[model samples]
Target: MSAWIAAAGQALLIALLAPIVTGVTRAVRARLEGRAGGRIAQPWRDIRKLLRKPPTSPEGAGVFFSAAPVVLMSTSLLIAATVPFVSTAGIAGSADLIVVVGLLLLGTVALALAGLDTGTAFGGMGSSREMTIAALVEPTLLLAVFALSTRVGTTNLGVIVAAGASDPAAVFTPASLLAFAALAIATLAETARIPVDNPSTHLELTMVHEAMILEYSGRDLALVEWASAMRLAILLGLLANLFAPWGVATGTTWTAVVIAAAVLTVKMCGLATLLAAAEVYAAKLRLFRVPELLAGSFAMALLAVLTSYILA
Candidate 1:
C-alpha cells in the first residue's frame, strides 16, 4: 500500500475507534465500581445527539469562540493523518516530533482561547489552570519522546517506532521504562483523566476541562467533545506504539496494514482498560498538588533523556 493510503486508513481507523475507546474506559470504570455501565457505544450516541442540535454561542463571543471547535478538530485530524498508528509508513516528513507536538499545542491553545473568549469566570479560571498545566505537560511530552529519539537518531515518530520494532530489547530498557511512565502521566493530564482532572465531575471547584467547555452547546460542544476523545485515543495510540510497536507495519503490504490496524486497536483498548483500572484506585490530587505530580513526570522524562544518552 502507498504511504498516503496507509495514512488515510490510519486516520479513519483512529476516528472510528476514538469514541469506542472512550466508551470502553467509562464502561470499565463503571464495572469496576459495581455499576452496570451503558453500552460501549454510548459516546457515539451522545455525540450524534449533540450534532443534531443547533449550536449556540455565548453573548459577545467572537471569532475565537466560533472558530475554536473547528481549529481543534482540524488539528486533531491532521495529527491522526500524519501519526503512524497502524503503519510506520506515515506521510513523508510529516511525523516529525516537533511538528506533531506543535499540532497538539495548537489544538490546546485554540481551546484555551475559546474558553477565555467566553468572558466567564470559570472559563478564565479553567484557561489559566490549563495553561499552567500545559506549561509543565508540553516539556515532559517532548523530553519523553526525545529519549526515544536519541536511540533512533531522529525525531521522526515513524522512524522511532520502526526502530523499536526492529530492536525489541531496546524498547524494554530502563530508559524506555522511564519515558513510558512520564508520557503516561502526561497523557493523563492532557486527557483530563483521574488523578489529574475528573472527566465525570460536575463540581465547579473540581472541574478543569469541563469548566472550559461549560459555555459550549450543541454542535460546538459536539466538536469539542469529539476532538477531546480523538486526542485521548491518539495519545494512547502513541503510548502503545512508542513502547510496544511489535505489530506495527513497517512495509508496504496491504495485509500488514490490516493486521497492524487490528493490533493498534487491541493496544489502545488494552491501555484504556488499564487506565480505567488505575482511575478506579486513584483519587484526584488537590489543585495545588497537580504541579508536583507533573514535576515528578518531568523529572522522569529528563532522566529518561539522560539515561538514553548515557546508555548510547
Candidate 2:
C-alpha cells in the first residue's frame, strides 16, 4: 500500500517538476548566451495561458486528432509512474523496463499519427522525420536496455536499480558507459533537443517537432507542450537513476523517500545543466545528417550489447 502511494507521489512529483526543469534549462541557456531569459516559471505561465484559451481543431478532424494531446500526456505520466525515480518500486506488473520502452514508442507513434491526421505538408514532413528517427532510435534504446539488463538477469526497472544501488561501481564498466552514450543520444533525439532537433525553433523549414504541433492551439497546445517537458524529465530521470542509482531509495519509507527525492533533484539538475551547455555550444544538424548521427548511436549500442555478452 505504501509502495503504491509512493509511486503515485513520485509520478505526481515528476509531472509537477517537469516544466520547471525545462524552464531551468531555458534560463541556463539564455544566460550562457548573454541574454536575460524568461523566468523559471515561464513554462508554467505558458501552459496556463494556453489552457485558458479555447482549443481549435482543423476542419474534418477525427477523434485521434483531438485526442492526441491527451494520449501523449497520459503516456508520459504512465512512464513516470512505472520508472524508478525516487524509489525502485511502482505499481505491480508495470515496472518492467520493456514496458517503459513500449510506452515511449507508443507516445512517439501517437504524435506521428496526429501529425499525419492533419494532412498538412508540414505535418506530413514532421511525421515522416519523426517516424524515421523513431525507427533508428528505438532499436538502439532496446539494445541499451539489454546491455544493462543482461548483467542483472532481469528486465524489471526496480531490480535493475536495486542491482545498481547495491554495486554503484558496476555502472562504470565499458558496457554501461557505451549504453549511457547511446541512451543520451536517444534522449536528445526523443526530447527534440539539439544536433537532432531544436525544441526552441519555430522555423518550419528546419523544425521537426514544432512543425507537427503547428496546428495545435489553446488547451491542446498546452497539453502537448506540457507532455514534451514531462517526457524530457522522465528520460533524464531514468538516465540519472538507472546509470547511477546510488542515491535513490530502495525502500518506501518517508525518510528514505524524502532523501531520494532530494538526491534525484540534484542529479536531474546536473544532467539538465550539462545538456543545456551542450546545446548552447552545438549547432543543430541538417535533417539529412540526423540519420547518420542516429546510426552511429545505434552502432555504439550494438557494441554495448556485445560487450555485455562477452563480459558475462
Candidate 3:
C-alpha cells in the first residue's frame, strides 16, 4: 500500500511538473533571443484553455484519432510510475529498462497511427518523419542502456541505479561517460529538440511530432500536449536518477525521500536549462541529416559497451 501511494504520488508530480519544465525551457530560450517570454505558467494556461474548447474530428477520421490522446497520456503516466524519482522501493520490480523503452515506443506508434488516421498531408508527412526518427533513435537508446546494464549485470533500472549509487566512481568511468553522452544525444532526438526537430515550429515540412496532432483540438489536444511534456520530464528524470543516483532514496525514510525529491528537481532544472541553451544556439538539421545524428549516437553507445568490456 505504501508502494502504491508512492507510485501514485510520483505520477501526479510528473504530470504537474512537466509543464513547468517546458515553460522554463521556453523562458530561457526567449531571454537568450532578446525577447520577453510568457509567464512560467503559460503552458498550464494554454492547456486549461484547450481543454475548455470542443474537440473537432476532421471528416473521414476514425475512432483511432479520438483514442490516441488517451493512450499516449496513459503510457506516459505508466512510464512515470515505473521510473524511480524519489524512491525505488515502489517500482523497482515491475519496470525493467527494456519495458520502459518499449512503453515509449508504444506511445510513439499510437501517435503515428493517429496521424495517419486523419488522412491529412501534414499528418502523413509528420508520421513518416516521426517513425523514421523512432526507428533510428530506439536502437541507440537501447544500446546505451544496455551498456550500463552490462556493467551492472541487470536490465532492471532500479538495480542499475542502486549499483551505481553503491559505487559513485562507476559513473566517471569511460563506459559510463560514453553512455551518458550517447543518452544525451538520444534525449535531444527523442524529445524533438532543435538540431533534430524544432519543438516551437509548426511548419509542415519541418515538423515531426507536432504536425501529427495538428487536427486535434480542445481536451484531446490538451491531453496529448500534456502527455508529451510528461514524457520529457520522465525521460530527463530517469537520466538524472539513473546516472547520478546520489540523493535518491533506496528506503522509505521521510528525510531521504525529501532529499531525493529536492535533488531530482534541481537536476531536472539544470538539464532543462541546458537544453534551452542548446536550442537557442543550435539550428535545426535537415531531415536527411537526422540519420547522421542517430548514427553518431549509435557509435557512442557501441564504444561505451566496448569500453565496459575492456575495462572489466
Among the numbered candidates, top lDDT falls to: 1
- RMSD to the true structure for each prediction, in A, is 1.2, 1.4, 1.3
- Write down the worst ten-residue block by lDDT for model 3: 86-95
Compared with the true structure, the alpha-carbon lDDT of candidate 3 equals 0.86
Which residues of candidate 2, in runs, are more than 4 Å off? 90-94, 169-172
| Per-model CA lDDT versus the true structure | 0.90, 0.87, 0.86
Worst 10-residue stretch by lDDT in candidate 1? 85-94
lDDT of 1 at 169: 67
Tens digits of per-residue lDDT, candidate 3, 1-312, equal 377777777788788889988988999899999999987789999999999998999999998898999999999999888677777776632578888889899989999999999999999999999999999888888888888888778788887787778886653466787888889889888888889999889787799999899999999999999999988888888889778887878876667766877888889878898989988888999999999989999999999988877776
Sort all candidates by lDDT, best to worst: 1, 2, 3
Q: Which stretches of candidate 3 lie over 4 Å from their true place?
A: 170-172
lDDT of 1 by residue, 180-231 (tens): 9999999999999989999999898988888899999899999999999999
Q: List model 2 lDDT by residue over 1-312, tens digit each.
A: 476788788889898889889988999999999999999889999999999999989887778788889999998988887788888754622378778888888888888888899989998899999999999988888888788888888888888888888975554467888899999999999999999999988888888888889999999999999999999999899899879888888778889888988898888878998999999999999999999999999999899989988987
For model 3, how big is the CA root-mean-square deviation?
A: 1.3
